[model samples]
Every structure is written in C-alpha cells, then in structure tokens.
Target: MTGFAQLLDQLPLRFLLASAGCLAAGLGVWGATALLRRLPGVALQRSTWLLGQATVLACFLVILLPHSERLRLVPPIDVADMAPSRAAAPQGPTARPAVGGAPAAAVPGADPASWLTLVAQAWLLAYLLGFGHAVLRLLLARRMLDSLAATGSRLPCPGQPARAPVVIEVDAPISPMLFGLLKPRLLLPQHLRGFDAAQQQLIVEHELMHWRRRDLQWLSVGIVLQTLLWFNPFMRMLRSSLSWAQELGCDRDVLRSRSPAQRKAYAAALVAQLRLQHATPKTALAFGGVCASTLAARIALIREPSPAHPRRARVVRILAIAALACVFAASLAFQPALARRSAPTATQAPFSCTVMVDAASGEQLAREGHCDERVTPASTFNIPVALMGFDSGILKDARAPVLPFKTGYPSYNASWRADTDPSSWLQNSVLWYAQQVTTGLGAARFHEYVQRFDYGNRDVGGDPGKDNGTTQSWVGSSLRISPLEQVSFLRKVANRDLPLSAHAYDMTTRIMPKRTLANGWEVVGKTGTAPGLGRDGNDDATRQYGWYVGWAKKGQRTVVFARLVLDAKQESAMGGARAREAMLRQLTARLDVL
Candidate 1:
C-alpha cells in the first residue's frame, strides 16, 4: 500500500472509537442532570450541560493524542498467521482472466474487500453532502436576517447607553429577536409596539441576556459540530439538549432580579409574542420562539423560582468540572484497550510479517503474522554480497571505482542507465552492479560464504548457464529466508558477528540508508524487492514481494527489525521504498526506538 493509504486506514477507526466514548459520556452526564433537576439554583442545574460540552471537547483531545504511545502499550499478535488452521479447506488458485469473463462466485457470500471499499466511499460521500447542505442552510438563514435588517429602521431605547443594542422596528411576522454576532441589533415586530412599558422591558431584558451570555457564538459552534458529525445520532441529540439548556439558562438570568409579579408580566409578554409568530429565523435568537414544552417549562420556572446558596452552587460546578476532567483522563488512558478491540482482524492485511528483537540481549520482543514463513531473499542478499566483496579485497572501500554500465544488458529503471560506484549501487539498488560482483566472486566462493552466514535455506545453486547463476540464485532462485532469519542476520551484522574485516563492516554501515529521529536516535535500513512468483526476477508482469530490514541505535541501546509483504498485485503491493516506510511507521508506533 502507498504511505498515504496506510495512514488513512487508521483514521476512521480511531475517530469512531472516540465518538463512541464521547456519546457514552454525554449520556452519563444527561442521566446525572435528572438528579439535579430539582436543584434551587439554575446555575447548578446548567452544570450538567456544561459537563457534556466539556466531555466532547475532552474526547477530541484524546483522539488527537499521539496514537503511538497508546499502541505501544499493546504487544503485536500473530492473529493472521493462525488463520490457515481455522480455514475449512485449502483455497483454489486466485488467478483470473484479464479480459471480459464471467465473475467468480464467492465461497460464502459477498467479496469482503470490495464491500469495505464501497462502504468507505459511501460514508465519505454522505459526510460531504451533509456538510454542504448544512453550510448552505446557514447561509440562507443569514441572508434572511440581513434582508430584514436592511428594511427595518433603528430606534433608540430609553434608559440605555448609546452603544447599547440598536432596536429595529420591522413590519414582519416574527417575534422580538436579537440578530447578528457582533454589534448586535434587536428586531422588534410592529405587533409588539402596543405592549405596555413593563412588558417591553421584560422582553428587552431577555434578548439582552442572550447577548451577554454570547449564546449565538456557542450556537454557531454547536451547528458546526453537528454538520461535521452529521452521521452521528448522539451528536444530534447532544446538540438539541445544549440548545435547550442555553435558552433555559438565559431565562433564569433574565428573571434573577425581578420580583414574582414582574416574572408573571415577563411570562405574559412571552405568550403575547408567541401569538404573533411561532417560528424564528435560524440565524437569530427570539425571546418567545421556543416550542410548547419549553414555554411551559419556562412559565413554571418563573412562577415558583427557588433561591440556592452561592457556596453550594460553586461546589457543584467544581465537582462537575472535576468529573469531566476525570472522564477525559480515563478516555485517553484506556484508548489503547478500545483501539485493540476496534482494530480490524489481522486477516484484512494478509501476507505480511514483522519481527523486532533487542540487539543487546538477542531477545525477540514481538512477532506478527507469518514471521517464520520463508520467501526469497530478493535484493536483501546484496548486504552479504557487499560484505563479501570488501572482505575478499575485490572492493577497497565505499568509494571504490564505478562499475561501467552494459548497454546490452536489460534495464528497468532509468537510474541504472549510467555507471555507478559501490555506494550508489547500494543506495539505488542497482541490480546489474550486484550481478557483476556476484559473477566476479564466482558460485564456489559465494556458496561458501552463504553457508558460513547460515543465510536462508543456504542454497546458492541455480541454472548453470544463466549468467553464471548469480542473478537466479540470489534474486529469485532457490535461496530463501524468513523474516525471523532476516532479523537474526541483521543482529549479527549489528554485533559484528560476521567473519568480515572491520573496514568492510564500517564501509557497509556508512552506505546503509540512515534516518535520524527527533529523539536523536538513528535508523539504518535496506529495502529489497522480488517477484511474487519465484524464479522470475524483477519481472513487472508478475506480482511482487517486498522486504525492509534494519537496526536502530540510540546511546548504548539498539534494536533489530525486519518487515515483509508478499504475493500482492504489482500496483497494489508495497514496493521496496514503501516497504521501508511501512517498517518505519510500525517501528515508530510499536517501540521507543523510532
């Protein structure tokens, strides 16, 4: 897979898990609100909605936390490697006709890969459509409000400062409402012109309270979140609840200083405004635009308001905030556990293996998939090839003389077209240069060294007349090695256990690709590629196999790892560079070695 595809594979699952956690926390807070319903102070009751909002914010923070740290807590498992034994029978050949032909019937039902691809694409399309629709609706609402403002006339209200909200009188079928985010204006329908001074004061107080609390800004936040998570039902429910809480909180604040008789007058004004218009513009907050149930609740709250102790209310708010903090911490701490359960079964990415070992103790730290399954060494054999060339005095150093390119030889990559030196050969994976080195050493000496290194199946023999058996034997012939053996070989190289001169080892290290991490650690690695079908070296027609083997060092500690992917279609399969990227991603996530 491409690096971008691999990174995208991880996002959806993580987002879903975090969303689930946030929903659960919201429900828990909603349930707690029920017990607080009878509290005398509205501030204490409003704490529940605040807790819900804080919980959602915390969930997002947890989602953004570095996944590597969490993933490292769980050791890798070989779940894919164990799948063959669970199968009902051996599978038939996977090859199919290239042109128009009858499709093959699935063994059980639908094809899982195709189904997953369709589902992912459909979800993304739905999200984009929903978000676009929401944005358009918001724009429409804003236009309606702007149209009303343009036709109305602004008037000055008594006992208010010049910089206070500018009151606008409009001939529209709408209740008294406040519109605009900054420099807000209150829109008063002509129907409200006949109301008494006391009722007008109560209505103005209610709209101003909404402005003081910046309810419009918070409403915009809610709408944006609702648009982004349009597919999540829990988010919809939470947003509705938050809207109700905002209105109710504003109601309590508006009535805080009024007497019981004045509260009754405020309720009457609310009812009178409702009779004129039942609906409010989406971009504006209306004093009497709430539904029947909310209106009744507001009237009841105004009729029998209860006072609460300031100290007690303060304690309750603190406790609620503390509860939200705890939930946030717990979500982050348990993310690995949640991720483990949500992680796709190993069968999804089949035919891959990973092995990591501690360089100091020579102990296996982790293994996943078929780490012990043997495959061709591919271009990875170049490591030993280079070492043998240096030790035998065939090459003096890393900067040894360049090998002249042969025009008659078949070339696949343009980079291999020109003559190259030993360092460039290893860096660019120049196949021809490796073949020349192998041919110069001859099969006899090469076979002797392969046996001494205990490399793979240790079979160096191949077709006798085919380029002296150098290309076939090492690239795609009988020679084979497992990911486990690759790690062992790399460990030996890191420990200087091979029978090579110190200069040869140093020169080889100097030529290895090195990537430095932010933590000051260094990763040295090599990539290898082979044909999916053995005995076919570097043929583009066949599928491909890829390998990445390397060691990481920091201070006195070191780690050796090998990652491999096999038997995949050429276009979809990980190539040599992609294999190295995959290995680096896995290592950075699973270990502290970067």
Candidate 2:
C-alpha cells in the first residue's frame, strides 16, 4: 500500500460511519415493526417481522460495504538471487554469447533477497471475499423487494394519491405508528385511505410528524449497518431502544395540538380504521411491531392521565454517566501500574550492555553487558562534534553551512566508494561526511569533547593516556551505546550544559522525526542505518538501530529515552516499526495521550 493509504487506514472514520448507520437502521425497523404488530387480527409473528427486517438490513449493508478497508504491514521474506556472469564460456570452437546472457556465479553463502508478497496476497483474498458477499446481499435484497412489490397493494385515494405520511407499512392491522424516529413510514391496506376524513387526518398527522423528523432516513441508515455487523448484540439493543424513543416522541408531538378528548377520538378512529381495512398496509409505515399486550399498554397510556416523565430517571442517568467516567479514569490509572507489575523483576532485566551516566551529576542509573561495547557512535556522535565544533574557532559559526566534499575512503562496515558535500553526507548519513567532521575535530579535541560531556564510554582504544581514535572491528566501530546511555546523553543536551549554543542544539533536534504517542506524549529522535548487519547484501535486510533520545511532555518538556532495532525480515518493515510500537505502548499505558 502507499504511505498515504496506510496512514488513512489507521484513522477511525470507517468504524464511526458503520456504527452510526447500523444504529439508525435498527431503530427504524423496530419502530415500524411495533406499529405493524399493534394492528388487530394481523397474522404475522414478531419472529417473521424480525427476519424480514434483518433481510432488509442485510441488503442495505451490502450496498455500503465498500468503505471499510484497513491497511497493515506484513513481514518480509527472502527469495533466491540469480545473477548473470560475464566471462566468456570455454569452447574449442568460437562460441557466440548465449541468448539472454550466460548464468552468473552465485555468492558462496549469501541468502536470498527479501520481498513483501505475502501481505499482498492476503489483501487480495480479503477483498474478493468482501466483494462477493456484498454482491450476494444486494441480489437478495432486490429479490425480496420484487416479491413484496408483486404481492402488496398501495392504499387507494379519492383522486391521484397524495403523499400523505411517510411509513413502512407492515402486514399488521394497526392504524397508529408504533414508534417514531427510525424509519417512521406509514402503513395502510389497499383501500384504507377511503376511511372518513377525520380518521384519516389523525393517522396522517402521527406518521407525518415522524416523516418530518426524518426518523425513517436515520432508520434506513442504521438498518444497513446492522445487517453488516449483526454480531454485536449491544448495537442491536441500542437500535431498538432508539426506535422506541422515536415513536414516543412522535406521539407526544402529534398529541400536542389535539386536546385530551381529541387524542381519545384519534385513538377511537384508529380502531375504526383497523376494522374497516381487511388487510394491513405492507408499504413499510403502519407502525405496531409489538403484540396485543404492548398495544393495550399504549391505549391504556393514552386513556389514563398523561404522567410526567420522572425526575429520578434523569438523576439515575447522571449517576450512571458519573460512574462510567470514574471507571474510565480508574482504568487509565491502573494500566501503567499493571504493566509495571506484570513486567519482569529487576533481576530479570537485561544486563547493562552500556552504562548510562547522568551528564550533570556523573551518576550511573543502569548497566548492561560486562564488557564496554564500542559502537561507531553513528549520528549520535554528531552532538559532541557540533559541541566541540562550536568550542573551536575552526567551526567558527554554528550556522555555517555543511559544505560539499568528495572522497572514496573505504570503511570497516560501509565503503566510502564516492563522496559528496559535508551537509549532504550528514543529511544522508554518508560515512565520509561524518568521518571528515570527526577527523576535522582532531583526535585530542574529539576525545576531550567526549570526556567533557560524558556522552559515552570514554575509552577511545589504545593507552588510557593516549587520545586513541576509533576501533578497528566493523561491529565494534558502530556507535554502540545502549538505550539508557543514549537517554542520559540526551538529557544533558536538553539541559544545555555543553558549550554549544541553543541554535546548534535546536537545529539538531529539529531534524528528528516527530512522534506523538497515544498518551499525548510527544517525542522526537534521529535514526541510524548500517549495512552488513544482515546476511543479505541488499539494504532491505540490513541491520538497523535507532536512538530515539528525546523528551516526553504533556504540556511541558520532560526528557525520555527510546531505542529501536530495525530488520526488514521482522516486524513487517525496518526495525523502527517494532521500536515505535513498544514505545507507543509504554507511553499509552503511562498516560492517556490520545
């Protein structure tokens, strides 16, 4: 996937849209079902109604299934490498070069190259499955609609039928809407509209109120979603509840203009219409998705005094909200502590591979392996270089442009096959540019800078008295400070104890990538790349490590350290992917950043 697409996949918009649609459709279907079942002598059972409702939802969901694609990284794999050879083939007679060139000699022990084909194949399979499901659902919905259209008849009116009220007429005998908001369509039989004007007016007013509120539209949207994600029972309940609330709201509105006596009359009119119409309206809106008991309860509610909604319910709701908030806060507070508790004990912690000493106090907080590991110091060594450069007159200004240079010096790990400008080299992590800056600073000066700052292990090799230069071993030559030491150096840099000016420090820090953790903490850090670390010669599988030496802050700055290892063969892409995940999890557990 493209970088932009990958980024979008991580966002929550797709989930939000799907959830909202499902809720709306569910509520609408429930309201319509309730209204249909309330009608007298309606033969359809709630089970049948629910089945049809689900079918309708499934069909709508199929149409909207295209929006929910997510992107994820896949691990890298190796493939055999085949190279062509150029030497002339041995032959007694003169032989022309073979077609498509002769096969080249293979490297004795080299592994194959890495490819990302696995993820691509998986994505293809998922896409095909989703597409097939959507097509099948759409066809099923079309078939159901066709069958309904063939068997159902519209309510006949005096002249051309006027758009009276919006409803989802069901196979029920009810005249009043059962619910309000979600898909509040009106239901009627073949000749139900021929009822007396007064009776028709009352029914029309109720359903019209629902239509005006746009309940049906929201219901349709929700049903589509429910069909797609039917497994979530909680979502289903929410849909049903919302539909009930919608119907109640419509009833209140319809009754507002009518007197208590008029409402009673309206209820009576509904009964008369039910008796006159032999068959219930099946065009969605006839309301009444419930049984006789619910119908009796609604009628009773209408006949009895209109009881005001209790204030206790509101108080209970407030308390519920408060309780939820408290639970959320408690969870947030507990996660980090739980993480720490679950973490391995101090004795199980990795040995100090490198000792981290506070620059200001010269204090060591953690240690790793027994032997002092020597690393090439990678870009991290640049901090001291910049500092010493500022101290000496040679660098002169901290703002001096990194100049271009060319060289072909070979190094222990990477070959300086060709050279470029100093700035370009540093920008691209070119060994030659980095070495020149290191060399220009002089061995004594570089050693002094290392000692003055306590940036890392001070032994530069050779005698302790002598200002020895770098190590000879390729692995040993790499900048090898552990995560703890890296953070210690950064803490000092952030404190600005070194002679380097603020401009120099800020410039260096600004170059690092900005990563915002879930817990609202922000970190910035630089990355490093080295070759020959992996079995493959290609850079794709090369060994990679990074020092995310940065500060974490909610609103103010608090220094923090993060180190990452990269390998194309693991954690999908480069090692940064794994490192980022670990750091993000830690940050999230510690603070609710997002």
- On TM-score, the leading prediction is 1
| Model 2 segments more than 4 A misplaced | 1-187, 191-198, 217-229, 256-285, 291-293, 309-594
lDDT for predicted candidate 1 compared with the true structure: 0.66
Question: How do the predictions measure up, each by TM-score?
Answer: 0.54, 0.35
Clashes of 2: 67
Question: Per-residue lDDT for 1-594 in model 1, tens only?
Answer: 221222254344444444555666555555555445455553324445645565765665466433322222232211111111111121224433212222222233222233433454455566578778888988898888888888999877888766667899889978888878777889988788788898887788888887788887776667666666555555566566666777777777878877988888888888777777857755678888677776887788777765647787776667666666666665555443221111122212235667789987988787765454455777788889888888787777777868788887547878899888889988888888888877788867887888788786565654322433555776655466778788888898999998889987988888877898766668898899876642212243345668888898888988999887754555654467668888887767666732
RMSD of each: 18.2, 20.8
- Lowest summed-lDDT stretch of 10 residues in model 2? 336-345
Cα lDDT of model 2 by residue, 342-395, tens digit: 001111112112223333454443332221222234554555555555455444
For model 1, name the residue pairs that clash: none
Evaluate all candidate structures by whole-model CA lDDT and list the values in order: 0.66, 0.43
